[model samples]
Target: MKNKIPNKIHIIGSVGSGKTTLARELSSMLNVPFYELDNVVWKRHEGHEDIRRTEKEREEYLNTLISSNTWIVEGVHNEEWVSNSFLNAELIIFLDINYSVRTYRIIRRFLLQKLRLEKSNYNPTLKIFFKMFKWNRYFEEVGKPNFFKKFGDYDDKLLVVTNKKELENYFT
Candidate 1:
């Protein structure tokens, strides 16, 4: 089936679910700027310290992006703090790939980042790698369900993709 995606899109998914990759592709294809929630949430001012932005700051920043006519916002964040983006988005894409596939991607991405074969927003270390796996598990068990429940009201605008092929088909 052919789908007409909107310019204002919000992509939500668990870690390693290809949210970033999809966001980048969509941004290029649609010629719209994309923002990663992680960057807006965490600020590494100096070294490895993750200084989180205040709720007001994040809201202001997000408001600025949303004020634009077209944009793509992607991240794993599903908290109330980010509800504005969801509300403002014309479409919400959820990458609901299988746990096994996500796990494999996580490991592969970690290795690539560690080897400097891939660029990452944060430092690639054993600690962060292990944390990713843990986060993945938590997401699969808890976050995914919570997202469904919380965003159920937006089902009409939500597009759930369970595999790469399905996502490619939708985009095509």
Candidate 2:
């Protein structure tokens, strides 16, 4: 790793792509706070019932996070409202891990969550588990391409990671 790491970083990936995992590692290594985009979109509550934030609220909340000096923001969202994160970030990581790899993770995660071995923000219901698969496919077919189209201009800072080892290499 270099003496100086990016102060503001944004990470985007499909479900089970390890976005949150990377963010947490970086946050711990850099001693910075990290926020997940899922929490930004949904206000979590007890008993696994979450409320979706309004467009205006989501934007405002995101803005507040990006306004910080040093942070790692990770999520699967890439849209107009999230443009500011890209603009403000010193590093943007696109986790393009293999589709099959992510699928395996989804299954593993759901089983762990169901067994209470893993802590998840939402309930590990059958419906949500199926949706994870659907979301992963959607990301592969639509989200990944859309992200490249939308954020390609940030190539100077963008790090397209196809494998986790590449991330370690980046830091070392």
Candidate 3:
């Protein structure tokens, strides 16, 4: 499976499903650059509020990355704007872990971030933590079904991993 992985890989999954972790691992193993869609969407500025990039800017940034020879892009976003990334990807990994596991990870991540043990892209707050749970629920109820309906055509290149064990086995 590792040998079968292509140069251009895109990973999409529900929140706390380890998209970033897997992308970083694969990027290191495959020696490909990795991109986080959140970073592209939210522009982080020191001592100032983070701002979202304009639609055109986001599209251009994504296009530039996708045009590269080899790269790994990971995010929970599976929107129409990001369809080009899906189309251009040689391989797409979808993490479909169970809700219980995902929720646990979400809480664990929040605790770690709050304790300063783990770094987060955004500030960790009580409101944001609860919102994560809601997002997880929304993804499970709505996002997953939509993803299946939309990207089912890409089954040839799509790999659905249901748990951490499967994910580990795939890269072994």
Candidate 4:
């Protein structure tokens, strides 16, 4: 059977897993709008400090996005607040990239952001840079296994991808 592209896709992974990049590509290929889960959690204003959204507001915002006809949501968050996205998605892509690759990406991304070669929602400071490593490791140990345990019920439609090439087959 020919693979059919999904209208509502949920992409999840640790930091530097290329969730944003893949989401953007898929959004273009699928002709759908994409949103970052981080955006839902924080209110961003260019050249100003970002404000964290209230829990209720974040839920409401996320709900609005999921309620749309078509969307691609990518994020590193794996919590009760985001469980609805998993339930609502037509396809769930868990990016299980190599730890070493993620580590390299984390460093590269921070450098790009610092050099202003790339734009960031938040200021790239030394503190956040350190936290990215911590978060990446946490996701590997606690977050990775927790995802399977919690969201494994959706395995029928879930696609665990370790490499970006794997996605090309599905999209093409």
Candidate 5:
């Protein structure tokens, strides 16, 4: 097995796949800083897709975080930023829960957010939920295999966790 005491970890998954939740958990378990990619990519805005900032700014932010010797970065934009962010990661956990469970969680998360009027930098809407699900499907059908192949070429440290129980055991 690769080093369990990873200085850096990247969690990549489709929407509602529990990437952020798992990231938070791992960060606490590992005593490392954690960052949510969506918060970095999108500023707070209403009725807007929120313009993406320049790549340089993003890189700068990531550099600052990764320089800390330990961090858990989670997001769906693996295709765009995984290599740069995860190249040095001692572990990469890809959450691959069932579609039904993910959909349920997405809906529940949306309702909770709306009811609580949560002050999220990026709000979750029904449209975004469906789009995310579609993206998740695409990833399952195409993204995961391709990512594994590509990531394998770079590093041998990877763990594909399908459920929370499995993840807990692996981490333990």
Candidate 6:
């Protein structure tokens, strides 16, 4: 169990921004529970359309973790709706890795998924492809503002980790 101080941690980034990778690493480093928002957003089910139906359900699940004293949550959702997690988090790490880096990672992830024929609840279509591109662009444009709004200028509770070396240094 995590103590009250620094118990809650949140990570924000685009797809393939290494959010989960860093979260898992931090969980081991800090000895705290790590919660992937993807898992919370979609309940695993056998060919069920309703499995990932409601944002409300996802929000509720997150609320449960926020109520707890210790948790590290990672996802690429809007900062507005997900503010509660950050509000509780003693630290918030945003991975602002270069667009090329994230693009490479996403492409690699796609290839691996295709090779394994893995069944993911999330969309793996061209729509998602464009979405990923748009997300990367938004990170530079729209997303940065929200990030700053929630975790920067007004707040000093955020850490922006842009490269593997920076991440390593922070965790080390």
Candidates sorted by lDDT, best first: 4, 2, 3, 1, 6, 5
Q: Candidate 2 on 103-137: residue-level lDDT in tens?
A: 99999999999899999999889999999999999
TM-score of each: 0.93, 0.97, 0.94, 0.97, 0.83, 0.82
- Which window of ten consecutive residues has the lowest lDDT sum in model 3? 1-10
For candidate 4, lDDT tens digit of each residue in 10-74? 99999999999999988988899999999999999888888999988998899999999999999
Between 3 and 6, whose TM-score is larger? 3
Between 1 and 3, whose TM-score is larger?
A: 3
Worst 10 residues of 5 by lDDT: 117-126
- On lDDT, the stronger of 3 and 5 is 3
lDDT value for candidate 5?
A: 0.76
Better of 1 and 6 by lDDT: 1
Q: After superposition, how far is residue 137 of candidate 5 from its true place, in Å?
A: 2.1
TM-score, candidate number 5: 0.83
TM-score of predicted structure 2: 0.97
Which regions of candidate 2 deviate over 4 angstroms? 1-3
* Tens digit per residue, CA lDDT, model 5, 1-172: 5345777888888778999888877778778889988766655467776877677777677767777777888887765554677777778888878888877877777787878754455666778767867887887788778787777564577787888888867766
Number of the top-ranking candidate, with TM-score as the measure: 4
Q: What is candidate 1's CA lDDT for residue 34?
A: 97
Can you tell me which runs of candidate 5 are displaced by over 4 Å?
A: 1-3, 44-49, 117-119
Ranking by TM-score: 4, 2, 3, 1, 5, 6
Flag the better candidate by lDDT, 4 or 5.
4
Q: What TM-score does prediction 1 earn? A: 0.93
lDDT scores of the candidates, listed in order: 0.89, 0.93, 0.89, 0.94, 0.76, 0.76
